[model samples]
Each structure stands twice: as structure tokens, then as C-alpha cells.
Target chain A: MRYSLFVGCTIPNRFPGVENSTRVILGPDHLGAELVEINEFTCCPALPTFYSTDRVTWLVTAARNLVLVQDKNADLVTMCNGCFSSLLKATEELENVNKCNFVNAALASVGKQYRGRLVRREGNRSIYEPVRVRHIIEALYTDFGREGIADRVRHPLSGLRIAVHNGCHFLRPTTRTSVDDPAKPVMLDTMVEAAGATSVDFPDKQACCGAGGGIRLQVPKLANAITKDKYECIHAAGTDAIVTGCPYCLYQFDHAQKDLKVHPIPVLHISQLLALAFGVDAEHLGFEWHFVAVRPFLKKVDAVGVV
Target chain B: MTPGGAPEAQKKRSTENGSSDAKSAEGGPLIVEDSVFTGAEHDPDFVKQIIRYGGKDVQTCLQCGNCTGVCPVSLKTPYKTRNLIKLCQYGYKRIFFTIPWICAGCHRCHEHCPADINPAEVFVAIRHIEVREKGVPRFIRDSTALILRHGFGAIPSDDIKRYREKEGMPPLPNTLPGYRKVLSELEALFRKTRFTELIGLETGEGAAGERKARERGGEASK
Candidate 1:
């Protein structure tokens, strides 16, 4: 299926590997996925701004992005969970209740507007394919048949103990979202297994990494405390590596290590881990893009027949 | 979503002789209404989401000074148990930032909230919505700058980084990009919505920078 890849803000400039891996994994599968980023798609500025409750500015920022998606007439795919959640929520709100009209009013000076129509009902651009904050390896298994996926693995990383940190807004948690159980998430864990790595079961794996969602700003102590708890738990699991599907979560776990006495566990995006199995350069995957050194964990990556 | 301070007409009425009179008159019990109260029509569902998200169920509590008396920081700030319930009952927007940031997150209020209000959590959700609207504060421009630019939130300038350094941080890599990256991203979003022309923000920092650049050029030529 054809789709437009809206890389969002954090991915391209900060975590370029996420964009690279998403394109790499999906492109090889012949998904015909296209990421034509509209110039000037800003921060969505969700980091700490979420406290404002000025839904108009936030919703309109999202709406403007949707206008670009609609203009391309392609389902927008994103790699960042925050971007996915905001953009997806805006698309749903605009199309369903039209709550986004006020956002349009706020954006009137920009000469941009959201028409609020999903192409699933039309002949083109199946909106259902818009997996903004998606796990690329999971998408391969779900979208492209997994019949030959294991064959693509250059090495099995079965021995590498891994913890999956699913970011906020990526999963359908509870009744507020649609997909899987938010309270007990297994999607990222299951996807990690397909890449031949053990999804080291850890307590509080589904909990937030303590970034974004205004937690860092609104409640810094709690955010740090919770992140500290996550670090301790992941360490207790004896996991050499931590994996996530969102740039925001990656930033949180990677950064939280700085403030606490947790073991040096390298955080990996699911795509980055999959690339490891596929023999992609750890450096090219933007290894330098990490604050926590990942070489300690990469040494654990299975080479040839060994992990 | 008709946001950003009440309209002049609405503000006139809210502060007018009518609403304040109504607020004190109805001091006994608050009722939800669809037209006015946010949780009016779907009181049960709204209350459930509030509780699920870790907030006080104002529906349960019989207001008492028990929460205020038990609160640790209540004396230092205007925050008290009763004020929280009053705002939740009204769905006041101001709590978006204050409740979370100022509370210091002891959860003592949640322990004391007679109505079972997790004031801390309500503040958190409010802050979440707030962050979605306004950008990060200017003070945190450095921390966010470190995270976005350096790839990790740990830097010597960053609070977390200072902690890590004292704790004997390993030679961590610096993944943060130039500050210009953040500027361009914001400028792009603002440009997308033509937010400047729309909100009349004088086009944000980029324009301010441009103006400075032009002045510098004028000085150079002189």
C-alpha cells in the first residue's frame, strides 16, 4: 500500500536512524511506502507544552500536519509515538466530532485547514494503514507475511536479554484507545521475539519512561522518581539491552540513566534491533545519536553463530 | 477548545453579578450539566476516566478540611483540598500547569483528599494537555535542548547530567544537535499554520534573531 511518511520532528533531526530503519525495513518488503515530508512540520511542541490545555494551538498544529497528509492523499506513517498519538488523535477528532474546527479557526492566518475526511471510505489512501507510531518489525510481520522474515535475520540474538519500553500513546491502552490492552501490552515484546531476541520480562515495562506527556515539566520529581523505578526494574531483569518504538521513550530511558545509578543498558528502537539482526551498521543506524553508550550491549549482539 | 482566556463577553458575565452569586448560593453540592458542567450528560463515564487517570472523584467525597489539614505543602501555596474539588467540579483550565508543578508530588493530598481526588494526577493530566499547547518553558530550553540536540537528557548543564556526573558517569556520548535544529522545527510548525499571522506572535524567535542579524549587519557596514 502507498503511504506518506511524516517523520515528525524528533526522528529526522535527532533520531535519524528511526527514519532510516523504517524506510529500510518497509522498503525492502515492497510496501511502496513513501515519506515525502512537508517542509516546516514543527515540534508538534508537545514536550512540556502539554500543560497549557490550550487545545486549540496543539490541535491546530496537529491539524496543519493532517492538512499536509490529506494534501498528499496518503496515510501518514510516523516513527515517534508522541507524534503518532497527537496526529492520529487529531485526525480521528477532526473526522469524527469535528472538534478540530476551532483549531482551523486558530490556524486561519496560516492559509491551511483540515477538511476532515479519511480516504478509507474513498477509493484511495486507506487511512487504516496510517501507523504513525508503529513498530516497523511488527509492521513487517503484520503487513508483510512473516513467512520469510526469519530468513532475513543474519543472526539470532536469542541469548541477549532485552526489555521493551513501549512509549506512551503508542499502544491502545484501556478504553480510551482501540487496539490492544494498555494495562498488559505484549505487542512490542512479541515483535522483539521475531527479531530473535528474548523480550526479557520486566516489571513496569509498560509504564511510561517519564518523558513527554508534560511529566518532566509538570511533575519533574515524580517523572524522575518513576524513571528511576523503571531503570531499577529493567536492571533487575538482567537485561543487557532495552528496546522502544518511540523517540520520546528512547530519550527518557536513555536520559534517565544519567540521573540514576542504573546499569548501562543500551536502549534500542525495535527497528534498530531488527537492523542489527539484518547486518546494518550500528554506527549508521545512528549509534552516535545515543547519549548512553550502546557498544557494551552491541558486543552482546550475536555474530555469525554466536551471541 | 474555544481556548485562551474567556472571551470578553463571557468574562464579563463570569465576573458579573450572576455567576459569583450562583457559586456561593450553590455551595452545598455541585451538579454536572451538559450545557455547563463538562461531565453533565456523561457523568459516570467522565468520572470513571478521571479516576482511571488518577484524579479525585469529586462525586464521592463529602468536603471536609481533612484533606487540607493533612496536606504538607498546602500552607506554602494556595493549594488546598477544597479548591481542587471546586475546580474539578467546574473543569477549570488553570490547573493545567499549577497543580502538577507546585505540588512537589508527595501524594499526601491524594492520601488526604476526602473526595478521593488524586490532585497530583489531575494536575499531571492537566499538565499533559498544557504541554501539548504551549511549548516548554524558557528555563527548560536548555534541558530540552540537551535532550533533543545531544540525544540523551544527560549533560553537565542538565540537572540530570549533574547528578550523573557526581555519580561517576561513564564517558557518555553527546548526541544533541545544534540549537538551530529546534528553532527550524518550531519555525516550520508556526509557518505551517501561519501561526504568526494567525496568533499575532511577532513570528517568534527566528524573526527576533533576524532582526538582530540585520542590526548586526548595519553595524558591520557602518
Candidate 2:
């Protein structure tokens, strides 16, 4: 139940609410999952921009973060889809003997080694273990199933309609990350439903939020155009809010709605929703930091007597 | 595969047609030189490098339009993922300099690719080649610069800090101790891989210098 929380770069800086809500919900008083922070961890280096540009450096950097978690002897749980994919992909690729040797040589220059899967002798026997990396959503879904999560909800979000965005890297490159089915993902929806909210099944539910691959930062017009499509679909679904597991997607939906001049709808991370359902104060969850105001959604949640 | 291997009949027709004045309506047909097929142009090394860089499924690409059909950016941009894959497989590395940047990395293409090509990863490989030879795009440079300076890609500003504090969270949560050392080590690693040069950090010579160096290296290798 213990994990080295990997809050990637964007979540901590751009979306502190995600970090705050995750900590609050997973704190000992709540779900009670032991969340440890490894300060040595740097950016997941972001897959599309950094990892794509320099594969060797990306592997080494991701391996360095993994090594830090290994130092803690804890499984890595990432809140950002980019970080989860980068670290998990690196961990999976480094399992190859040749790739492992290559990355280890690079790591050695940094005074680190990626002994990814290690064997330790315990008395007359040996135990082989590989580092486990999971996205926070997957960790929650697996650790606490629908009923388990529902049992923890003090105030159910009875009538709220939420559109779930699973973000690309969360389910994609499935060969590298088999967290959920790439095409028909239901874990995010399942988690959304567990909070007693209606998980609206919208068209293109699996589409990209347009923030991936640094698109939102670079060619923002195109990014906003893509985001507009997602918004249009969500709006058509008449959802009260958009809920996502990744911070980048949350940022995209939150900011792109304003940039595109679409009617702003509240966007919440799964942790924030869980915290709200658990009767945590809205002010404590950092809703004010959001570009799109969460008042409308908060009012709805409050109307449901969840606040 | 022979260079300038046009049929003799066509050559004679071109000679009779007066190729110099062929563009004029009064003149005969234009003589088009056959494109030379050089071993240097079709580099298997580039293909190998793409696979080496994690585009392991690039070779299995069936040239299906599934990637383009599913690509969201392809609808608005000139970045057709399938075309990029085809070009990458054929060792046309220059197309990747800007095309791959258009990819949003949605993985929709990866999901629908009948060949399991993982066009997203192929784009990543193309981006790797692009960065090494042609320098990274400005957006990538900016992101890398932030990470190098703050140990995070996005730095929380004073306004953001104030907001975070109001939300019952520390201004900077999980600030790594001695991040300066971490940045230095990361810079060293970038230098070893020439990433700093690609992103215009260490040498201050920007991508123009990297492009010039690559052109010179390409000529030398030829």
C-alpha cells in the first residue's frame, strides 16, 4: 500500500490542486495509502518532447528517477500520464538485457545503476522482484474497486454528470502500458461512477485533449482547435463537469475552454472529485487556482449535500 | 536503379525537341532528368536508428492510412502520421524536422493502426533524429530550459505561489534539496548526448550551428 508518489512536473507546478487533492485523499486519514515523496526525482522529462528528442538522455533521466524510487524500495505511483508512461516505458524497455546494459552505462556516468529487476538472497532462497510503476488512477481502481471506493464516499455526488477524459498515454502504446484497454478503457469511468456521479459516455471519449506532445505549448491554435472538439462533445453530453486523471488534460480542458471562447465547465482531477465526495472543503482542494471557475460544479455538488 | 537510365528513344525525342526551348508553346516537350538513385540517399542506418530509438514497429508498418484517418492534428496540419512513417522507413529524415512536431501524441493512431505500427513512437523516433541533426524546435528548447533551471518543466511563479498557499498547500511542494547539483548533472548528461547543443544550451551556438555541422558531416560521410 506504500508508493513513492511521482507527481511529475506539470501537476506540482501548473496544477497544485492535483498534488494537494492526491495527498489529501491518500493521506492516512483517508484512503490511508502511504505516499512517500522522493525529492531527487526530476521531470518525467515528458515523453513527446524530451524523450522523443533524445532517447538515450530520456532513458537515463527516467532511470535515474526509477533508481531514486528503488532506493526507497517502494512502487512508483505517478499522477501524470506522461510520467507514468515515460517511467513505465523506460522500466519495461530497460528489462531487455542489451538496453539495460546501455542505459546502465549512461547511468554509471551519473553514479547510478538501473538494477531494474534485482535478486536478493533470503536465507537459503532468493527472491526476484521488479519495480512496479502505476498511474494513480490505476492504483486507485485496482486497490479500491467500485464498491471499495463507494464505501469511502461520505457524501455521494448523486446527480452530477461528468465526462471522463482518459488521456492518451494513460491507456496508449498499450504494449508498453497495459493499465487498461487502449480502445475501450473503462477504469476512469469506473472510478468516476464510484463517486456516485453519472459517467457520461460522449463521442470520442478516448480522443486526445490536444495537450500531449507539447502541442498545446507550441502550436496552441491547433491544440485549441482540438480541445474545442472535445468541449463541443462534452457540452453536447450536458455534463456538469469534465473529470480527468492526468493534470495536462485537466489544464488543457480548463484553459482551452477559455481560449476557444467556449462556455467554461469545471474540470476536476479524480483525486479532487474523491476529496469532494469525502466531504473535504472545496477551498482546501484548490479549486480557485483553476482557470475555469469551479463554482458552477461546486454549487451542484453542494446542492447534492456533498460539501 | 541506374542513374539517368532513360530509354534511347526518349533521349532522341528530347534532342529533336530542343530541350532548352521546351517550355515554350512553340517548342517540343521538356527534357526531364531522371532522379539519380544513390546508396547514400537511401540510408539503412537511418531506419536502424529509428528502430533503435524505440520505433520498433516502424518496419512492420503496412503504409495503411489508418494513422492519418485517426490523427487529430493531421486534419488541421500537414502532419500525416502515415506519410511520416513511410518517409521515415524510406530514410527521408529531413521531413521529420517539422512534421513530427505537429504530432499531439494522442496515440489514437497507435490504437487504430492495423499493423500495430505505433505511429506515435515512430514520430518520437523521427523527432530523435530531427533533434540530433536539425536541432530541436523552440517549444522543446523552452521546456528543456525550464527543467534544467528549476528541476521542473513548469516553474510556479509568485502569483501561483500565492494562490497555492491560499489553497492550503505549500508554495512549492516537493522541492528537491540541492536541485542545483541535479541540474548540473542533468546538464552534463545532456552535453554527453549533445542534447544541450541540439537545444542550444551549452555551446550557445543554437540549432543553426547544429544544422551546419550536420550538413558538413553529411558531406564528409558521403
The per-residue C-alpha lDDT of model 2 at residue B55 equals: 82
The estimated TM-scores of all candidates read 0.62, 0.84
| Maximum-lDDT candidate | 2
Instruction: Tell me, by TM-score, which candidate is best.
Output: 2
Residue B97, candidate 1: C-alpha displacement in angstroms: 6.7
lDDT (tens digit, per residue) of candidate 2 on B141-167: 666766676667665656556766666
User: What does candidate 1's lDDT look like per residue over B1-222, in tens digits?
Assistant: 111122333334434534434444333223322112221111224345455444546666566767666443344334455556555555444333333444433344554455655565565554444444444343233333333333323222233333334433222233233435534444455445444333333546534433443444344223
- Tens digits of per-residue lDDT, candidate 1, A1-307, equal 4466655546654566676666665564423455454443444445233213334445665666566556564556666776666666555556444465566665565566667434365565445333243334335555644444556776667777788887656663111343444557666776677668788877756655665545554445555665777788888888888898888678777777866655678887887887787766666566666779988877777443462
- The TM-score that candidate 1 achieves is 0.62
Docking class of 1: incorrect
The worst-scoring run of ten residues by lDDT in candidate 2 chain A lies at A171-180
lDDT for residue A98 in candidate 1, whole number 0-100 = 49
Give residue A20's lDDT in candidate 1 (0 to 100).
68
Q: Scoring each candidate complex against the real one, what DockQ results?
A: 0.09, 0.34
